[model samples]
Target: MTKQEFLRRYKDENLTIGAEYMMILDKISDAPLVLGCAYDQGVWKIYKTGERDGHYIIKEYASENEAFDFFYELVLSKHNRRNN
Candidate 1:
């Protein structure tokens, strides 16, 4: 889906525009790729890449929906597009 569409659909949920983030993953030749988001006291979160058993998660600094959207789009959408 387009970014605008995503924003519209999740607007009531308090989505934000132009979120910022950095991603870290295992760089070994055959290591599993994970998505990480730095939020809430600067903790590193690992997201499963579906090659293994794990959950798709959202890490946000604030309890509000906008904060969640910022982290989710910044970390999730970017990685997904690249991997695809």
Candidate 2:
């Protein structure tokens, strides 16, 4: 999806676009954002969103499962913040 669409869908949180990916910031305390991108290699790049050197990281993953796990971890972090 386009950055605008992503932002609109997750407007409650902060959103930013990078060179190759888009990220959705967390609404709850102490939770990192969710980062992802559509890739030319027929796979989606997903990671726990963070920045350095003014760029969002699409962390290198050995497999899709690892990337997806990070994504879920971010979600769990958010949920925990919401519940407690």
User: Local error of candidate 2 at 20, Å?
Assistant: 22
Per-residue alpha-carbon lDDT of candidate 1 for residues 1-84, written as tens digits (9 for 90 to 100): 333443455555553322332233222111234444323344333343334544455443433344435545664466566556
TM-score of 1: 0.25
Per-residue lDDT of model 2, residues 1-84, tens digit only? 333444454455542233343443322111243354333244445444444433344554545555455554554455456556
What would the TM-score be for candidate 2 when compared with the true structure? 0.37
- TM-score for each of the candidates: 0.25, 0.37
Pairs clashing within candidate 2: none
Question: Model 1: C-alpha RMSD to truth?
Answer: 11.2
User: Candidate 1: lDDT of 9?
Assistant: 58
Backbone clashes in model 1, listed as residue pairs: none
The alpha-carbon lDDT assigned to residue 61 of candidate 1 equals 41
